[model samples]
Target: MPTDLVLLNSRLLDPGTGGLLPQTALAAADGRIAALGDDRGIGALAGPGTTVVDLKGAVVVPGFTDGHLHPVSGAERTMGVDLSACKDLASVRAALDAARRSLRPGAWLRGWGLDPNAFGEQPVGFAAVGAVLDGVPAAIDLFDAHSMLASPRALELAGIDGPRRFAQASEIVCDADGRPTGLLLEDAACALVEAVAPVPTEGELLDRTAEVLRTMAAAGLTGGHAMDGMRLGFYAELEERGELALRFRIAPWCQPGADADAVAELVRLQGTGGALWQVAGVKLFMDGTIDNGTAWLERPDCHGESTHAFWPDPQRYTEVVGELHRAGVATATHAIGDAAVRHALDAVEKARTEGGREVRHRIEHIETVPDDTVARFARLGVTASMQPTHCCEFTRADHTDNWSRRLGEERASRAFRCRDLWEAGARVVIGSDWPIAPFPPLTVMAGARHRRPSDLSLPPHGPEQALTPLQALQAYTVNPAWTACEERQAGRLAVGFRADLTVLADNPLNVRDTELRDVPVRLTAVAGRVTHRAPDVS
Candidate 1:
């Protein structure tokens, strides 16, 4: 007989039934919802020693679940240099100078989220960044995280000596003289830099994980799917320490070579049944990103480029995806372009034919899905896991000539159509892709509803494919839960469901569009225990 707590006088929004009930009371006991109904009905179920919280005029809804986010990368970035605010070369140099002076000598100086285009210039070379750092080793990531600007000292440390050739499916944008430009495009350069960089200790990783969980809880998020590159035994360690607070569905990046062996190891490590800290899933990258002009396309956009750099061998991708499916491990692959999407769909179809159905795999991004592939997702029972903010972020670019010319007007309309996918019968799940965009569910909801940032006007980009506020909310809540296969125990507010809910300062349905980003999360509860609460402003 665990003590019960009754949340009274709150407006409840249930996405499961598309219903809004006012002055509702929700009772929680033994880490599960005991009763939920009108105030009188719920009050009658409350025991004598139960606690009662009057929410007054606030709104209550199921806790948000970010379907995709890089929690580990995000945590590390929080302690590293944040170039997200640097607007120009001068600002970048100034920040580098400041970081170099503050950091230990020869320690890797890393920064993320610098857009060369935003700095009002074409991509610059390493010398540009080197001149600013006065020869300090540094690596500044572009906004897409697909590319980076590395100083000469940093490249030297990575043992990248003279005229480095970009690996297959990777590009090393170079000067006419064949000298390595500061920019490292695609996974080749990224892998080199990562191999040389310092790996955080187990303790440090756990500390960072805790910090990220607190931040997510503050943002009204109680759970997320961590899609960070595989760091062996990372989740196991966190779970052992009991430091992982938020519900995490970790999908480790698949390693090259021995696909079956690697997946077997992952499965054995996962043990029987899933837990809050770890679940069974392997992440694969089928192609490059659109921001860097690497997304794979069937017909070379007007740019004459058919696909972003492929991983040298398409067989490796097929092997990895196929083996995981055969082993009964769920797979989530990143496919942003039409060609990559088709390729991924083909792999899933093959897996189903050979390995039998029941492999509930998913396609990440689907930013530029083609019309023909929409129905294929539903027929194959593949989940379309997408991020809403990318649509607004990319569409708002003023200079769209390059992208528009490459993607043609007709084909561009198919970009990130959440509503269209839903109509096509795809199980559409929304995610923030966090370190790439804000993780606040309210912000994501607004972006989907408006199809543009608050300050930007709706580009005729895909307005007809935009989702309503309620529909967008469902994508963030129930759809993600369904994709994760946790719908019965999570996502909704019915009896026997997890007591995970967020209390907002105002009803989201009544809040202004602009106010969505600023919506204050008054309280957050996980497993029937309040984890976060905003101080009373009055």
Candidate 2:
């Protein structure tokens, strides 16, 4: 038998049952928890061969699982220039100049998180950014990753020229006279630059995956679900190399017209499974984000214009979702507006009726759900996978008014209603959607509790929607584990559960809503092996 590891003298939070036990000791042996009870008497379970870890004045909770994040995209963004930190065109130019001098000639200059709105009417043209790069081919993605601004050199490299370049679903925004304005929207941006940008070698991707896992682990996240399609091999390679440090649930990207091809590919890659990594499901996008005014709202906005659109054919989306469902795979659809959410629910209902139930399909980002649609989620047995940070970030984006005007005052109350979802008998899971939001679970917890950004002095967006600290913790822990289909084996400190846990500097149960964001992670462990330990703790 393997030697047991014991953690004692700590507050144990069981998100699964919404229970907190004071002064508990948990024992793990052979990568599984062996015992959990009051610390006063549980020490006897630690044999002579056991290694004891005194958690000493800390709170221990299950390892966090980020229900939605693009690990491959996150890693790629990490390797590229981070335009997210740039304040304006001048800063963008400065960063480009630095990247230009550092790279070899003709190398692709890539960047992520460049918001034109952040610059406030500065008219971000590729020429200005291109001049700073000394004419090297370059592409800088907007903060949303839904758009890109590329230089002429980049356009030439990608074989995009004049009006023939952009696809039907995409647009190359040009000046009134039809001159290229350097901005590529939707598929045009992804197709022209990101598609052809040299994919990192398998080894490079694996290394970066390790780095990303470490970074996330340090932030108190033990696992995450990657929602990008292009980087499937990254997860496979990490598991093959035995370098994956954190648990991962991968949801490969899905698109119209490619359902058969994607399903076949997934079948081929099905052998790549790990205790730390698994193909959670397929990811589909029903509509674009609200920040870009592309969420498919039900009714036209008060401004007398529709704020959204769909994927050309609603039936095609339903067909693809059905195919994946028939194959016994789970599905996660991104739906921010009422129309998009309804469309996704309709597809899932059709798929469920045709193929019969298999796994819990989920709708990610229910930003503006309609009043009538709340019961539909529970009726169809679909999971509401949401990101609480979105409420705060969207508030900062100043789009709440748009939602209110489009969805009506009463309908708008359903946004990010974690409590309401639970009340309606719908499973609600939380995620950071990192690279779009911060990864710290504490930040997410605080956002859920306050329903507003910490810096905002205004009253909480919807006080009725706010989750108690205990409820917020479950959203981050047990709820995500259930969504990932790992609740039984993980998400709790039970006798037979996996020994994945995080120790915090302060007990979240006692911490004030505002103080939640300030709480630091003391240590993080996976399967009895310590992965991260804060410098001053342990």
Candidate 1 local Cα displacement, residue 201, angstroms: 3.9
Candidate 1 displacement at residue 520 in angstroms: 1.6
Q: What would the per-residue lDDT of candidate 1 be over residues 291-323, giving only the tens digit for each residue?
A: 667778877776566465265576777867777
Best by TM-score: 1
TM-score of each: 0.90, 0.88
Q: What is the C-alpha lDDT profile of model 2 across 55-100, one tens digit per residue?
A: 8868899887787887777777767888766656778778878888
List candidate 1 stretches off by more than 4 Å: 38-52, 87-90, 104-107, 119-121, 127-130, 163-168, 229-243, 270-275, 301-309, 397-410, 454-460
TM-score of 1: 0.90
**Per-candidate clashes, comma-separated:** 2, 0
* Candidate 1 residue pairs in clash (backbone atoms < 3 Å): 126-182, 169-309
